[model samples]
Target: MARKIGLYGILAYVVYGLFFYWYLFYFADSSLQFEYEGSKADPATFLNGRELMLTEEYSKIRNLLFFLSTPFEWLFYLFILLLGFGNAFKKWAENSSKFKFVRTAIYLFWLSLFAFIATTPLNYISYSLSKSYNISTQSFSSWMKDELIDFWINFGMMIIIVAVLYWLINKSRKRWWLYAWLLSVPFTLFMMFLQPVVIDPLYNDFYPLKNKELETKILNLADKAGIPAEHVFEVNMAEKTNALNAYVNGIGSNSRIVLWDTTLNRLSDDQILFIMAHEMAHYVEKHIYFGIAGYLLLSLVGLYLTAKLMEYVIGKWGNALRIPAVNDIRSLPLFLMILSMLLFISSPLSNFVSRYQESRADHYAIEMTQNTEAAIGTFQELTRAGLSQVNPPLLVKIFRYGHPTMLERISMLEDYEINNKAKTNE
Candidate 1:
């Protein structure tokens, strides 16, 4: 009877997870629905037939590359298994046992190095493809240097995190997940605070936006939107990529609006204002803090699930994997595997929240700009420049897209235009 109850509990948990995924995918925000039927013209009317075909082809290539990369990603999980089962990490850990935490840190460094080496080929292939498609202009050597820099930075941070996590785990066996989550709060915030200022400069050049006329217009828009930003930045993205983009980055005093040179080059002044307004909307709506909160909550849930799942898996395969305890350094692979699985399962929920936030920002942009034509034109230019799909498959939207489909965004603008015209007539 006890065994049957345990099995039932597992079944119930599985059902609950499935239900959560379904809810997030389909019913998370009924408010996002559009009232007006879409325009008679197709969304792809913005693109010529050749551009449309190229857009589709680019999307297909990306999807195929993603599909191919899945096996490589799964191979990473298998590699982790080998690290744990083959006692490679354990042996490394034992090699420096005379020092207190040195052995564990060394083991972590080795683990991080192995992961970087294993993943570099896929990263290289992605870069190669981007270059082939004329999306990236960064040279191979520059890309390699950037990747190595990224590796060292991430590896250093991971060592510190793993050390702190193990200290917490050793301190409390049952409540380690809670402690780890608490510890992550400050680390997450610090990273966000640091990335824009300290980290971004390692790769690209940013200058105070040089187009004085456009800069004046953007600051005026920022003031109108109550953003208080003084200067807009233009990143030298032309040297790196052909894709157009812009964003708001950092927090508090460090916060600034950054436009890719590609965006400034491709989009007109009015359209640029619309895009800046969109990014500014993120600040006014407090999306950054809300995003952090959402991620923290998700991480908490993922961690809790990982703890529960870890106990079960370890019970079954602890000896086979040479993983003695949750707190042990040798168990890092299993810990990572469980965390990855939980995050993967919960991704739709995360993306749903992001899409809603982005949709809100879109509405805010249109309202602030009050220029429906420029708003529509901006997305049209983005679709053409980036070769983005106007309407992706439903699963892609749910699982991968952090914003609404391009067609949906365009249709919402079309509805806004129709409704405003109706209001004017009334």
Candidate 2:
């Protein structure tokens, strides 16, 4: 039964991969063009011949990479379990330590290391693709350094989570999921709070916005929007990627406006202001808090479902999988597999919520700046710089896009311009 389940999972992934490949390379290219009536927002108008080619090629590969990543991860975990590496790691940890925490750290270190090594090929492929397309600026060594940082950070977090999760399971086997979800709320908030100050600076240098004149203008805009922002920050993203971005990060005191140095160097002052306004709108509308609430809600349900699924799987095939029980350390791979599957399934709904929030932010930026041309230009520049598809396929938009497409954004700006001009004429 376990072998059949694994076979079924592999079959499902292969079928999906084939469909995704067809959609991206063939059908999407031929049929997914976006048209904007009387506006120069179409891909052909903004992206040059070379850029159009790059965008098509880059978008296809990137999407394919994304499609493969999760399943690749699941396969790694599955292989580890099937090969009895998970049981071996658990036994090694048990022999190494009498302490539960120490044993967990030991077992999870091996697990994390294996997962990291397994995933490196995909990660390197992504990096190489970006480098080939003139997107990534980081050297291989520097990129590896960032990857190492990410690995360690993830491993550390996994240690904490696995430790607590197992403890809850041991304490209250049936209600462990409930307790885990309850505990996760605080942990999530704590991580969010620390992310800006503690974690971010580890990768890139961050300093107050150097352009004092523009800084003052941004502050004035924030003041007008009632955001109470004291300073705008500039991160040294030019060392990493050529992509342009501005964002609102953190909640409350940690909250601040952050602009990628690439954005500052590449865009005009008005364009930067439009980007800042868009970011500020996220704060003004309290999107971050709402996002947190939504995440916790989903996680609660997901954890509950995961618990039920874990029970069913282990009860049925515990011996075959070498997982004695749900709480057993050997079951970590199965736990992760179930969670990953749930996450993949839930991605479309999450992306829909994200797109709605992003659309609201776009509308707010337009209304606040009242500079439709600047907003439109900003979107165009972003597409060109990132080689983004102006209009992606329906599946791509549903599963991958967390923000409106470049075409949608530019067309909305054009409509706003028309509406405002009509009101003035009246």
TM-score of each: 0.87, 0.97
The TM-score, computed over Cα atoms with residue i paired to residue i, of candidate 1 is: 0.87
- Model 2 quality (TM-score): 0.97
Candidate 1's C-alpha runs over 4 A off are 1-44, 67-71, 83-86
Q: What stretches of model 2 exceed 4 Å from their correct place?
A: 1-6, 29-38
Tell me the tens digit of each residue's lDDT in model 2 across 1-426: 658767876898799889889888887752334346336677777777999889889999999899989888888887787778988998899999999999999999999899988999999999999999999999999999999999899998999999999999999999999999999998999999898999999999999999999999999999999988999999999988999898888876897789999999999999998999888888889999999999999999999999999999888877778888888888999999989989989999999999999999999988999888888889999999999888887888888999988778888888899999999999
Q: Check candidate 2 and list the clashing pairs.
A: none
Candidate 1 per-residue lDDT, tens place, 104-144, comes to 77788777778788888878888887787677889988899
Question: Taking the candidates one at a time, how many backbone clashes does each contain?
Answer: 0, 0
Error of 2 at 86 (Å): 1.0
In candidate 2 the C-alpha lDDT for residue 143 amounts to 98
